[model samples]
Target chain A: MSDFMEQFAELRDQKRFQDIVDAIPYARLMGVELGEDESGELLFSLPFHERNVGNTVLPALHGGLIGGFLENAAMIHLIWNRESLDTPKIVDFSLDYLRSGRPKTLYASCEITKQGKRVAHVLIEAWQEDRSKPVAVARAHFLLATTS
Target chain B: MIATPVNPKVFEPMGQLFVSLPHCATLGFQYLGADGRKPVLKVDWREDLVGNPATGVVHGGIITSLVDTTSAVAVTAHLERFETIATLDLRIDYLKAATPGKAIYCRAECYRLASQVAFTRAVCYHDNPDDPIAHGVATFMRESSPLPMLQEPKA
Candidate 1:
């Protein structure tokens, strides 16, 4: 393992979590932000940006961007919930677009439905305004990185 | 209303329309013509799009976006009109991590286009079509009619 990764494993949960998020280049390009809800669950948000728009007619956010946000949320959720320092590899991803994502700030949350020795399943939901009315939802299966 | 048969000529301009989107432009997506009725798109590998810094592999999210956008283009090609369409669902299976520093190509065909829904299947590859990096299936909700009012006035 690299010295940086070893040091990451030694850091506290909060710093380690931040490092993981920071390490993903795509997440930074999309300007994805991470925070926590009142219940201590991780919350992900993508601030409104013109570069996120896919359809100029409806001015809708790109479907892929929404999917990426949910996937990133799941990844962060997995890292935050687990103790491993290795990054998870995505096995498969499925997303259902519940509604057209407007060009506005979007929020997301993830739930780990199942965690096994070698794999993990996550459900993620992304919304714009109302939490109940999600713009998109997704399920992802990830192969956990083996600890040394 | 009887469904109109879309003219193949409509694809060129429609593909241009897709690449005009800000997000698509930001990701350097290009409309790489087509194969038959299917529309093909390409995104060259770049440092900013890497997911695994250690391996320099493109993120799965970028692949998802590429497939989703290519599928949408296929739907437009099937319709032969710039009707508003929203992705209803998209499922992508990553067969392997994308080869670093190689441009990725995606092609999709709208196999079924009903009044309200369009179904598409897509594949992403790096040098050979036979060996795909990812396979995707998606469904899109098609608006019954064009909503011209929602469109930005052409500058």
Candidate 2:
């Protein structure tokens, strides 16, 4: 536990979130990035890539990637502010598709709805150009870091 | 809605269309045609698909993608025609982490088809259905999508 605590503190000193994101292959594959919003709150964004296109006619982003991005967003937020050294695991994820994901930049943010010793709940919303018109919304339960 | 008859002939071809999809192709999804009347899909393991570099376990989201894609494609089995559909909602339960270095297989069933919606259930496993890695149930809004991905392949 002390070793993991040391590692966590060392990460907090440097580019913590970005370094963690870099280690995740799918997050890298989908071009998930962490940056500050206009108000300087940490935000995750999926940058446009041609391969990310799920619907060629409408030229829309793939539903899978949209779902993946939201899941990744929640995981990253939890990792960035995790209270335990153990890594969190997703238990279940549910998503609602409000509109077609445009083939452009998509942004997502997460809120920890409830936190407990062994589990946590998170709600996420993703939008394209307009924050008011979210393209997708999701909620998930994660098994928080547990002693190995 | 095109009142097309239930034709078994389109099953294989429809599966082919899904595999050729840009996203599916990019992820290397293989459309394994109906086996014993149940359509199965597979995606081989790739280093690029690894999520936890420490353990080489694939990302949880990949399972979601597989289940969602399979559940969506499974609707054609019931309708017996390739129609534009949109995923209205999906829930994935991660039963366990998938074994690394093994391809993942999925089986999905569209049990009910209402006028405008389809209900589906899917399972993702490595070698045995009895021990699934994740289970999912997804609902698709039929005829709502305008995607041109399903242009009628000339029979």
DockQ of all candidate complexes:
0.65, 0.64
Candidate 1, chain B, TM-score (2 decimals): 0.88
Write out the backbone clash pairs for model 1. Answer: none
Which window of 10 residues has the lowest lDDT sum in candidate 2 chain A? A1-10
lDDT for B17 in candidate 2 is: 71
Off by over 4 Å in 2: A1-9, B1-5, B153-155
- Report per-candidate TM-score of chain A alone: 0.88, 0.88
- Tens digit per residue, CA lDDT, model 2, A13-131: 58576666677788888788887678755699888888777777777888877888999888777766775666778999999999998888999998888989889899999999999
Full-model lDDT, candidate 2: 0.81
- i-RMS for every candidate (Å) is 2.0, 2.4
State the TM-score for model 1: 0.90
lDDT of 1 by residue, B1-155 (tens): 52332765555677877877888899999998877778889999999898777778898889999999999888877764456778899999999889999999998989999989999999999988789999999999888326641343365
Indicate the worst ten consecutive residues by lDDT in candidate 1 chain B.
Answer: B144-153
List the TM values for chain B, per candidate.
0.88, 0.88
